[model samples]
Target: MSDAASRLAEVETNIAEAARRAGRKAGDVCLIAVSKTHDADAIRPLIAAGQRHFGENRVQEAAAKWPALRGEAPDVTLHLIGQLQSNKAEEAVALFDAIHSVDRSSLVQALAKACDKLGKRPQLFVQVNIGDEEQKGGCAVADLAALLAEAKAAGLAIDGLMAIPPADVEPAPYFALLDELAERHGLPLRSMGMSGDYEKAVMLGATHVRVGTALFGARD
Candidate 1:
């Protein structure tokens, strides 16, 4: 197997083991190969090795890289996993199959308008600032419900909630809190976890783990 394939296998094995320990099946958790910053050349190997779901952080970068690559590999799924600008809503809606960073009512309105304009409704995940940190790119925890309501009022389909915990502190509580929020709001997806703490996220009922370095190695 190629190096990327080998690494991909290892990550999958780790995810499976984590799921088993949590008494859940591995398939319950979706692994999103975070392909931001890395060029299409860096991503093709993983796709060739059967990695379908990939994430990119920027609309411009994703637009630049994915179309041609996707033409060659039509089944690849693209996710927008970063803060989105209101002006770029139409482009994002056109490009990504899922967007994991819908954080505010303004963004919700923009996405709703874009979806209407384009006649497509990509899956939307409401990003919560689980840590309540000042510099983060998510709706404050206290504001999540209102945002969801806003999305609903705007006729946007909200799939679930996504979060990033405070760096270096325990993430389990944050993951648990996000899972609880999803449950209370009747949402289905929980976009939590990263390279270091995905196992913990899985144990606490995360449905999607955004793993980067584990699959792609260290970024530049």
Candidate 2:
């Protein structure tokens, strides 16, 4: 019952059987338990085996372990999947509620001046290197429509489109080209897979699937 609650119920039963073979309704895919570099007692047993969406890849190691692990799991939803640094964009908009690498325009004008000096606007995602990987960390498949029109002309609340599809081949044609650039920028979230192709990124519509080593098994 506890290899991190049986690999978090086998990655939530393979993200509910890949959303029932893509008829799509296993809560339409959102399993993001990536807890980077594994601490907080290896992440409090996957938040006592419920795991309310956790991912971190350094905003000071999620400010050195998520404000006392989100003050003992107050519905933890921290994500900042990795690679961001325009002077830490106001400590990643005061610690991540989803910022999956908003790839550049001076880090979207330093996250729109830290969301206008810390009002906070976290759900952005632009990251699309899709396989044009010049050392990855996305934002140039023909510059994703001028980076989503410069992240919505700087008020920035994009709420979709991320990617990582070049490693070891066959990522469903780079998660179907980040689901065809999120249906050509009508954008309703994609944030592609991990842990060896998150059920092919939820059968290629991946509303969000940043799994880590199949729910925390391999990292350091």
Candidate 3:
């Protein structure tokens, strides 16, 4: 098998094992192969390997490659996993099947407007600044309820909560915290973990794990 396909299979195995550890079925967890900064050539192999869900960090970058890639694999689902600027909401809505970073009220409003104008509503995840890190793009933990309320009031459907724990630290607590928050708010999905920590995240009830490096190797 090709290297990329081999890597994809291993990651799937890991995800299945982790899901089993968590007493959950593997099919219940969505493995989102984060394809940010990679071109179509890099992504096609995984698609051929049956990886239907992928993620990108920017709307323009995703637009540059995914249109053609999806043309080849119409079953592929694209997710916007990076922080989104309000002005890019229209383009992001048009391009991605799901968005994992709806973190603030203004962006929520912009997305609502875009969805209304375009007549398409992608699955939305309200990001929580679970670590309260200033450099991050998520809404403050204290602000989460308010932000989610604003999103609902704007007529946007919030599918779940997404978060990145403070880097270089043990992520279990943060993953557990995100799980608690999701349960508290009755959200069914939790988008947490990257390649480094996805197993822990799945064990902690993550419905979606944004895996990149493990599937694609280190970025250039």
Candidate 4:
């Protein structure tokens, strides 16, 4: 196998083992190969190796990179895994298949309008500031319910919840908290975890793990 394919395989194996330990099927967890910053040359091998879901952090970056790549590999599902600006909602709605960072009502309104105008509704995930971090782009835990209600009122369907725990800490508690919040709010998917702690996240009920470095190697 190519190096990228080998790395992808290892991460998949690790996800499977983590799922088994949690008594969940590996198929239940979607591994999103985060392709942000990496060029098409860096991503093609993983797609060739059967990776269908990928995550990108910026709409502009993805817009520049993915169209041609998708023309070649039409089955790939792109995910927006970063904070989105209200003004860019239309482009984002038209580009991504799933958006993992819907965190506010203004964004909700923008996305709803964009979807209506474009006649397309991508799967949405309400991001939570689970760690209560100030610098992150997520709805405060206290405000999540209201945001969800507002999104629903705006005609946007939210499929899941997403979060990033505080850096340099044990993420288990935060992952568990996100899972519990998802359950309480009737959200079925939980997008949590990244390269370093994805296994822990899988065991803690992460339905989707955004893995980049582990699969693509260190970025430049």
- Looking at model 3, residue 146 earns an lDDT score of 91
Q: Estimate each model's TM-score.
A: 0.98, 0.38, 0.98, 0.99
- lDDT of every predicted structure (CA atoms): 0.94, 0.86, 0.94, 0.96
lDDT of 1 by residue, 39-113 (tens): 888999999999999999999999999999999999988999999999999999999999999998789999999
Give candidate 3's TM-score: 0.98
**Residue-by-residue lDDT tens digits, candidate 3, 7-124:** 9889889999999998999999999999999989999899988999999999999999999999999999999999999999999999999999999888999999999999999999
Best by TM-score: 4
Name the TM-score of candidate 2: 0.38
Candidate 1 global lDDT: 0.94
Clashes in predicted model 4? 0
Q: Residue 144's C-alpha lDDT in candidate 1? A: 81
* Candidate 4 pairs with clashing backbones: none
Off by over 4 Å in 1: none
With candidate 4 superimposed using the best TM-score fit, by how many Å does residue 126's alpha carbon deviate from the native? 0.5
* Candidate 4 residue-wise lDDT at 162: 97
The ten-residue window of minimal lDDT in model 3 covers 139-148
C-alpha displacement of 200 in model 1, angstroms? 1.1
What's the lDDT of the predicted structure labeled candidate 3?
Answer: 0.94
